[model samples]
Target: MQALLKNDVFDGNDGCQYRVVKTSSPNTGWVINLSRAHSWPVERDFGVLRSHSRVATQSTACAKLPDFAFYSEKARNRANAAYEVIKPLILNADGSENDDILDERKRNRLVLARADELDISKTTIYGYLHKWWSQGQSKYVLIPGSARNGQNQTSGTSGRGRMPGDGRYSVFQMGAEDIKRAKEFLEKRYIKKEHASLKGVHIDLIAKHYSFRDGNGDLVKRPEGEHPSIHQLRHVLKTLFTPEDVKRGKKGDKNFDRENKPMTGSSLEEAVAPGHIYELDATIFDTFLVAEANRHHIIGKPTLYLIYDRKTRLIVGFYLGLENASWTGAMLAILSLAEDKRALCEKYGHPYDPAHWPADGVFPAKFLGDRGEMASRNSDRICDGMEATISNTQSLLPITKGVVEAGFHAAHCAIKDMAPGYEPPMEAVKRRAKKYHLDAALTLEECTSLILGQIIKHNTTAMENYPLSPAQVLAGWNAIPTQLWKQELELNGCAGANYTYDYLHLQLLPRTTDDPKSKKAKVTQQGIEFENCIYKSVDDDPTVRQWMVNAGMGKSPEVHCSYDLRLVDNIIVHDSKGRTFPCTLAKDSGRFSGYSFAEVEYIIVKERRAKKLLEDKTNQAEMSRRQRAQAITTRAIAATKQAATSAARSARKADTAAERDAEKSRLRRLQTSMPPTNSESKRVGNVIALHSSDHVEGCAHQQPKIPVEDAAERPRSTIDDLLRRKAQEKTNELTHL
Candidate 1:
């Protein structure tokens, strides 16, 4: 309603005059004249170009406008192609047109027209038609009798299109249920099919099930509207289904690539010199030991951490745990190595001390582990209290840690293959650490121990690829000066107590002792309770005896007991036949105060309360039996009285019957006496009263008949009363007797 605004598109002045040019082509163009008062330089109109004459055909005119031709040709061509494909589908219900005859030229023209309307390529329209035709061929069929019945369905009128705004025309061709089923099928297939990738075939299947169409023209086909391709399907799967890492690549891919390089061999040789590098990593074992040594069924799996000298491939230390991999676990393994070193020295009389460690054993310079924080020795004391910088070994390098990483990778692959779908429960992981050893035939404490044993077996036996045992290589290394060899051995053996802290030494306080034999300061006692049941004490030291005595006296001499529980000897209790019972030292009562083996001796042969209980049970049984007998006697007495009552009732009924019979006879006699008066009574009624009046004074009234209850009928009532009276009499008689 608001008019005459001079905007960008229509900038003409209201009062301006213009001249219309009548061209030779019979069309008009306007030229602005700004001489009028209202006219200004801004008076212009661009739409005047449309008023100019141009060619009627789009080809000629479109050529003049190159940009339009550039974009429109493809769009028109695709639209035409889509129209050609849909033309027949729209024309007839059935594809009754010649099957073998494809009119390429006509199809091309139709496709171009469709593309022009839809603004899509002819090729795109062709593709959509091709897919649609492929999918519908089997399902879209017309009944043969429909045409004869006068149903004039049009050509190309297939069940492919829907009314405008119908939900069936959604871009997702398939219904919700069908899509869900498809997704589920693909997921299940992916779970089982290792290398099968989700892509185009799956998408096409979905599109075919539900008919969808793009809206551009009433019947024109869209070139861009086509089924998803393989790439698109893959994108959906990666984005929606698979884990990121699996979709991208495997973990440690880069390290594995580096491992493939030729330089790796040389680097390994240098870094893993006999005692230079020690690799450690944990492996979870799903299988359990088939022996009584580890009899309990593990809830999940056992985690075993192994430390090996890469050069000799000798296991330096090992730890097994039920816990998931942790920093504490890795640290404890190092501690085991330290304890083992001390043990080896004492066991073999360590010909050379720490001064000659290199000669005594294999010593490691570097500690290697996967990216586990506890395994890193970068801190002042890498494992809390552990001395990371030992006297003989050098600090480890970061690159060297990759060895352990490689080991972990190997374990993951191998173990997963052996135990498919197996994952250790947390309980089993925690319990594993409690057990120091597990034996294949018996039990082994550390996985490293098993690895060491295996290495020894492999080297010594002719069963495998290795030519020499790891121990042999270790022996060769040991041939150096006693000092150097012992130093190396000490270093290798000194896995800081952090790794395998279960050893008895870590639990005990370190005490210096003047050896009676060598006059050297040697550890006199070794046992641990807190650090894993280890105990260390000197049996012969006078000071130790004195300390024990004083400690015992502090809490009532009897209450004072041995401090080292692990050192206390194990004892068993058995029956006469020697069957042992599960028993242990009573913790509540201190060792000295608790009853002795002799005092508890009686418990061995007999149950403490069994005899008294048996006697009580017998007495109760006898009392019950006597009470039952008395009840039977009472029942017998009552039955006798009942029988007596029945007899008395029978007798009384017999007497009553006899008395009734006698009464009946007397009544008959009286009847006979009164008979003979029938004729006399008829003669004179006054004559009967003469004799009666004379005898009246002396006559006695005839007695009324008396009714009696039969004795049998009332016998039951009297019987009870009689019995009671009889019992009372019997009681009195018995008292007098």
Candidate 2:
């Protein structure tokens, strides 16, 4: 085929030579386009040239070509088998191989004998041997009538499809204005802040005057002919866009980077020893955990912090929290690794054996963690205090700390997956669709025990990539992790030298400021206050109190204090001279006796906020009630005063009426001596009308004959005063009086 296609010329059926120009593959067979042959004189090999009258004729010969063949693994294996059988038979003619000569007769005899012994025909063995020598002793060869590339099959061209970030123009093709309208409909109806379903977007697009351009670039509309179907458009969308593309287009780059971007894998092949490197990370346990104290109350998911030994892939230690990840969890995990867990095991009802958990009090040479809780300044300081090299994994690269990451996944599979409230990845969505935690059955204590058992089983079982389990690899014992660690320790250990592992862990705990305003750590008569509790150094231990007493005497101006986040009952304080003092929880800390720092802190914050909220609500309700009471009281007071004033007015009206009658009788007696006037009859109509009476002058001459004591001591009634003043109101007498 290569020879035929590369040719510059080919003969036509008319005996005319044509120049081959181009070739292409279409729905039809291979077609060749050619130009007219040039007019060139032909020369004959014969002594005399024949004229056109001779009318010479010639014929072309053809032979059958075999199907395409190449050197495959099967063919190579067959040839190699034959060669192996015949290789021992071939010996040099001279015993010296350096002579590069072989006895052909001897070789032929040996080859035939070997073939007969192997039940292979003599001819086949000879053919294989001949081909081997002819092909420079190459065992593998391709024998065929047709040519083949002898390489893996290939399409020879890339597939016809859009790139990942490509648009589906061909799928939704139309005029610019129509396309714009379709996009507006899609975005407004589907891809906005409130996400909608794919079917919604499809229905919306189909409702518009949409058109499509097919693979052949012919525009078709629903009104004119057949448009792109929803299924076809869906296929185009899924093919043209990627998860990251949709993430960016629908949401934003942040979502695409956080959720859709691919993460690379990591390897532990570089690890050299069990205690060389350890990975630390925290994760939300998939299963819901109930309160240990009460099994019926589900506590939600737990934050599990694991310390994984990179070399052996052993879980050195772990810390489990109630429902969240925090720096305290990280500290507790380290504490678990540094201190013996016998008491913990006894508490949890797991068998206690130092040999089975040898890594209990050992620290690794290096600590690795992500840029979260483990990357804090306190964490760094703790690592420094413990003399371990601390390193942070690359941000967004979960694989850098792959050992812990994998450990978390393994634990989830071995334990969390089996729990009733188990939630897989994207569990939030599943949880929203159906409540899973509501059916939680395992309490924190029960869950912890199950997890411990799973870890122990993992440490003893063989791993896919490892010949032995992590425990076996670390301790060189086919037992639990603790046993392996213990056996290895009999030979060598590298946790620390100058100080004990417990002390080292204590050194890394969060430190408190010595500043006076942070009075929680101040050493008062009741001892130091921390987290609303008091911690006092007992004098029973002279060594411990010496640091305190010395610091008290102004021997040191500053003190260093660090508390184990794992325990709220105790804290370690180092004086300026570096003397260590252990402080115990004071009696005032009755409520916080057995609580961990994390638990206590969480409780304090939650309770405080809850109390604050309740107080605010109470205050608001009280103020509202007070305002209502004040409004009611104000109306009552005003009515009472109005009632009192109306009573006073009635009393004054009675007094005036009595005084007016008395004055009118006196005036009538006075009018008896004189002629009675028309105005006199109405003179005492009311005390206020007395001033308008014509008998005012006659009444003005008469004075009331009352006891002096009564006049001087008795207060005047309003009516009597009105009568008296009216009687004195005569024109001339009024001015004098």
Candidate 3:
């Protein structure tokens, strides 16, 4: 037998359950009938309860309490307010209640006083107290039972009276036939990609079924009193369909699946330890930033790639850069997972203790991310290199990586007030004069520093709602991210794998050559060539240095190399033994020293285009000059043939050598006396005379004429003439014989 105590519920022999509201003594107490018909308590004798065999403890007799979570927030709030009214009479710090307050006479007075003070009837107060005691003394019991019982099931003016409209327009109540028609209209017209409005559908329905034709065959609308109003149609539609069903119909299946589907579980549910799962995601910062090198150059908004741990809600690593969300940015963010937190903070100018952000150099067991970057082949390389798993959420489904997605929003909100050039919301932007970009002031480095400060603050701040395990709670672990991470690591064993930066950089960063499919980068006298840039081997690596020397001797070997598109200044070269050697940009390739792979490629393309255009112009000019020279040469040959024919005709009668000589002299004098020809002048321009006596008449400029004797006075000139004369004499002798 269960001992009778205050608030103990038991089954009564009269087929009714009763609660011991107050215990006066061991054998006697005051009990209340739990039935809603009775509100007052009656005296009971516990001594006589042993005699009744049917009377036994019935704690389960009370109705099961409703889960407050299922009810609307407003209903729960109202229930709490009602509970506050009778809390003073029923509850106390100690278990015992005042005997005077429990007396029937005083209890009635108190209930009446509370009801009057709260502007409610005393019967309402009594009902509240009965429910509180009958249902395990919980405040949620006071929530209205009507919603749970499915009462008040009237719709569309059945209980709501007349709809809102002008008095001239009569309102109509929706009948069963009218509701059926409205549902048909919703399915056929309202639920579509076009998303027709409910009012439009209602009007169309009225025109189709609630209108009459006139004598001229024109359709006339029926009186407002004869058809249901749009409000009635809407109420019927809501009752027939759920919000999700309506959303699915209006937005279509794809959109409904993407945006309106219910979430089954949390991202943290599977994360058993600190580094069990890490979510990688990227978002463009809501503020514009300036270039690090040139502050006047607005770089636009930078993309922030964040890696968040699911278990501890700690920001494991992140990358902030001008690069858009791509494999390069994702790789940088992943690389930061193994970076020293102290160095990172100090470099960003936010000095902090190592313990404050202790989740450094910890690689997650699994990497989860959206499909954009994580779906690429480069991510596959991470899986193979680190021996870890890579998972991508369904396309267009970001809820799978909700932890990182929410982290981005929280980070943005945290820094919105401090960040300069922050973009206002769309509503506020309409009211502002200047655009967000125009207000840009922070450089990329400065913005990165601000973000680092926020990350440190997030890691150190206590998360009151964080779910801690029983063991963690017993071990006195707070909800701070850093503390939780450390405690989890100690209890569950570190889920992070150990890795060196050099190894991760070599394995994770992109590796490319002139040939996209080729793994080896060619070494030439110009240095190691990769993506159209030259890289020289570092001095520390003797093997790479020897390879560079061999390259100079025309015995270069193709070596494997990896590089980050974000920073092309240096690359990692894998040698024969699988050792990584650092290589830097050669001096000759200084133009691409500080540029990214994308920028270098862009500049190369532009230069190639400009060179191509210049080469085309040069080719056109060469073709024009060649044509002009050919024309001039052809005219000179024609002039020579005409001059030879005239001289031959004049010397036809002179057969002897002396006569031939006299004729040549006469022709030479005639040529000198005549003015320059038009073709000659146009071709060579006017000539200048060396002496005044040698000038010719009727010429723009005269050619200087030197006598044979003056020409023979020069030593080299006499030698050329003697050789010609001797050869002519021998020819004359041979002809005479």
The models' CA-based lDDT, in order, is 0.40, 0.60, 0.77
RMSD of 3: 20.8
Best by lDDT: 3
Encode model 2's per-residue lDDT on 1-737: one tens digit a residue: 22222113344444443322222221111112222322211221111211122211121101121222335556555656776666665444353221111334355577667778998888777665444333223344324212234232222112233423554334323333543544565446544534767776766565555656778987654542234345544544454445555556677555555566677534545555567778899888888877768778877888888898775677878887773676778877777776656887887788876655656666777788888877776776655576688788767767567778888988888875578888776768653466788879887777888888877677766566544547556755554444444454555554432336567666767786544544235554455556767777755465444534665766433555787666788887666677777788877886798888778888889989999879988999999999999999999989977767536545756678889989877767564333333366478453332243464555654554655775699877999988877786775575876
TM-scores for every predicted model: 0.27, 0.44, 0.56
Best by TM-score: 3
Error of 3 at 704 (Å): 26
lDDT of 1 at 555: 22
Residue-level lDDT tens digits of model 3 in 1-737: 55677667666666666777777777788877775565567677865643353333445333344467778888888888887887777766585565544567788888777777889888888878777666656666788876456433434455464745668765676676777788888888987546588888988999998999999999998987788787778787788888877888888776777787976866667888888899999998888998778888888889999888899989889999888899988999999888877777778887769787677777888999877998986777778788889888777777788888888888889888878789855634476456778779999888888888888888999876777769878988898888888887887877878788877877798765445765458778667888888888776466776787798998987677877777789988876677777889998888888788889889999999999989989999999999999999999989967667545566765678888877766655556554445576577689632323344333524564566885778677788889999999999999998
Give the C-alpha lDDT of model 1.
0.40
Residue pairs in collision within model 3: none
Number of the candidate with higher lDDT, 1 or 3:
3
lDDT string for model 1 (580-654, tens) is: 222223332123233333333344335546777698889999999999999999999899676675455557566
lDDT of 3: 0.77
Better of 1 and 2 by TM-score: 2
TM-score of 2: 0.44
